[model samples]
Structure formats: structure tokens, C-alpha cells
Target: MDKIKLSKEEYENAVDEIRKFFECERDEDIGNLQGQIMMDFILEKIGPSIYNKAIDDMQKYMTEKIDDMYGYMIP
Candidate 1:
């Protein structure tokens, strides 16, 4: 797939919308299904390249959060 470029504003808006959608799920199983649907919608709307980039960015953000939490727990 060709690279799909997004302006900063567009990326922020997409992230906000995705977070809101996930917020509506009541449990982990439902949230996972909702996340998959959200991802499919995003991929369909934005294409693979942009979707993959978003996924990578989110993974990095989550890893940083986990590391921060681990650091807080260590002596």
C-alpha cells in the first residue's frame, strides 16, 4: 500500500475518536471486539500504511507507560 499521510490535527482527531469508541466497551472481551472493529474501520478509511503507523505509535506509547509503571514499583 502507498503511504497515507495525515496532518497532525487529523491524527489527533482520529486518536480521539478511537479512544471514545473504546471507552464505550464494558469489558475486556467486548473491548477487544470493539477495538478490532475500530481498527478495521480505520484501515478501510485510511489505508494500511497509516493504520500501521498508528498501531506502531500506540505500541510505543503503551511500552513507555509500562516502563514508567515498572520504574515506580522498583526500589
Candidate 2:
């Protein structure tokens, strides 16, 4: 996939969220710059696997729902 780019505002927002999550999950408050770095690392190392798993799950869910529809009958 092409390199994913976020606007500055969006990137800042993501960093803010990362800070909040670090605080919540680890009881540690991290600075915005640290958050940004962490987010970049995560996106590079883990994001594609997570994204692919979500897509696979969505496809499985849709396939099951479509099969259910096919099994339905008019009353």
C-alpha cells in the first residue's frame, strides 16, 4: 500500500489519543512528541496486520450474513 499520510491536525489528534491511551493503560502520562513517535512506530510495525485482520473479519461477517439471507424464505 502507498504510504499513509495524515494532515498535521489529524496527526496531532492521533498523538493526543495515544497519550490518553498510554495513561489509561500504563498509568503513565507521555508527552505529545513521545506519543507521536510511539504512534509512528506502531503504525509501521503493527498497523498493517491489524488492518488486514479487520478486513478479513468484515469479509467473514458479510459472507455469513449473505448466506443467512439466501436461506430465508417468503412466508
Candidate 3:
């Protein structure tokens, strides 16, 4: 599968969230450069696993709903 690419808006949102997290969690405000570097690193390294997990969760959710629907028909 191709790597997930965040849109400009999404990337900016993520960077903003990171900036918020550092402020709330560590009481430190990180600048854009640091946030972007961190965000890029996460996108390259951790994003794939997170994306795969989301896909797996969605698949399972659909499968469960389908099975529930089938149960009503089969019974």
C-alpha cells in the first residue's frame, strides 16, 4: 500500500495539535520548525502502523455489522 499523505490542512492541524500537547503536557511551547520536524518523523515512522490499525478497525466494524444483518435474515 502507498504511504498515507496528509493534506496541507491536516498536516497543519497535526502540527498545531503537537504544539498544544507540548504546552499542556510539558508546559513548554514548541515552535513550528520543531513541530514540523516531529510531525514529519511521526508521519514517516508511526503513521503507517496507525493507518493500518484504523483500516483493520473499520474492516472489523463493517464485518460485525454485516454479520448482524445476516443473522436476522438467516434466522
Candidate 4:
């Protein structure tokens, strides 16, 4: 798959969240550049697995819904 790209707003929001997490949990102040680097690292290393898992979950949900839909068909 091509690299996942977030919109500017999303990217900024995620970076801000990362900065807040470090500040609150680790007592460290991380700048935007650092947060962006960390976000990129996570996307490279962890995003694919998470994306696949979500796809699998949605597939299962849709399959179950489709199975239920068959029950509503007329004889």
C-alpha cells in the first residue's frame, strides 16, 4: 500500500496529542518536529498491522450482517 497520509489538520492534531501524552505521562516536553518523527515511526512500524486488524474486524462484521440479511429473504 502507498504511504498513509493524514490531512494537515489530522497531522497537526495527532502531533499535538503526542506532545500532550509525553508531557502528561513522561514529564517531557516534545516539540512538533519530535512528535512528527515519532508519528512517522509509528505509521511505518505499527500502522499496517493496525490497518489490517481493522479491515479484518470490519470484514467479519459485514459478513455477519450479510448472513443475517439472507434470513429476511422471501421463500
Candidate 5:
């Protein structure tokens, strides 16, 4: 599948959407609902395949960073 390239502004907007999704006044309230709604909107805009690939890439990057930090700590 071809990668969808986004401008810096577009990428920032997507990040904002994700942040708004999980940021709520109360964690025990309907925050998750709002988050899910935001996620659905984002997924609809980005498409499922791209969304999944982006998420997977982010996870891999984070894991690698953590591993690198762990390696440095052992020295």
C-alpha cells in the first residue's frame, strides 16, 4: 500500500485530535465515549490500514527507545 504523506500542519491536527480524544475532565465519566468518537472520526479520515500501520510504527519506535535506554543503563 502506498503511504499517505501529511504536511506538518496535518500531522499536528491529527495529534490534537488524538489528545482531545483522551483528555477529559473526569476519567470515570463519559471520557472514554468521547475518546472513542474522536478515534472513529480519525480512523474514518485516515482509513483503517493507514491508521493501523501508524499505530504499529509508533509502538515499535517507543519499544526501541525503551530498549535503548535499558541498554545504556546496564553499562
Candidate 6:
């Protein structure tokens, strides 16, 4: 599987959200660099499991839909 890469805008947006979360939840203000590092850590460590789960979810949904297709055929 290819490494997930976020666009520049998306990366910045994620960093901003991270900063906001820390400020709101922890009352600790983090800089942009800190937020980027945190986001990168999250992606490196946690992203794959999330990605795999999404793939699994899609596969299950498609399988169900495909199975239902059998009902559409004229007997």
C-alpha cells in the first residue's frame, strides 16, 4: 500500500485542528511545528489501522450490495 500523503492545505488544516484541540482540551498552546509533528506521529502510528478499517468497511458494504444483486435477476 502506498503511503498516505495529505495535500498542503489538508496538512495545515489538520495541524490547526490539533492546535485547537490542545488549547481547548488541555489548556496548553502548541506551536505549528509541534502540531505538525504530532499530526505526523498520528499518521505514522495510527493512520494505517484507520485506513484498513475503512477498506474493510467498504469491502463489507460492497459484498452485501453484490449479494443483493442476486435478487434482481429474473428467476
Model 1 lDDT, residue 47, Cα: 83
TM-score-wise, the better of 2 and 4 is 4
Off by over 4 Å in 3: none
Go through the candidates in order and give each one's C-alpha lDDT: 0.67, 0.87, 0.93, 0.92, 0.65, 0.94
- Compose the digit string of candidate 3's lDDT tens values, residues 1-75: 676688999999999999999999999999999999999999889999999999999999999999999989954
lDDT measured at residue 65 in model 4 versus the true structure, 0 to 100: 97
* lDDT of candidate model 5 versus the reference: 0.65
**Model 3, global lDDT:** 0.93
Best by TM-score, which number?
A: 4
TM-score, per-candidate, Cα-based: 0.39, 0.70, 0.84, 0.95, 0.38, 0.94
lDDT string, candidate 1, 1-75, tens digits: 655556767766666566665566642334444555665567568688667888999999999999999999957
Better of 3 and 4 by TM-score: 4
Q: Which 10-residue window of candidate 1 scores lowest in summed lDDT?
A: 26-35
Q: Per-residue CA lDDT of candidate 5, range 1-75, in tens?
A: 345556767666765666654455334333445555665565567676777888999999999999999989955
By lDDT, the better pick of 4 and 6 is: 6
List CA RMSD, all candidates.
14.0, 3.0, 1.7, 0.7, 12.5, 0.9
In candidate 1, how many Å is residue 56 off?
0.1
Worst 10 residues of 2 by lDDT: 1-10
lDDT of 2: 0.87
Please give the lDDT score at residue 55 for candidate 3.
93
CA deviation > 4 Å runs, candidate 4: none
lDDT of 4 at 58: 100
Q: Which stretches of candidate 6 lie over 4 Å from their true place?
A: none
lDDT of 6 by residue, 1-75 (tens): 666789999999999999999999999999999999999998888888999999999999999999899879889
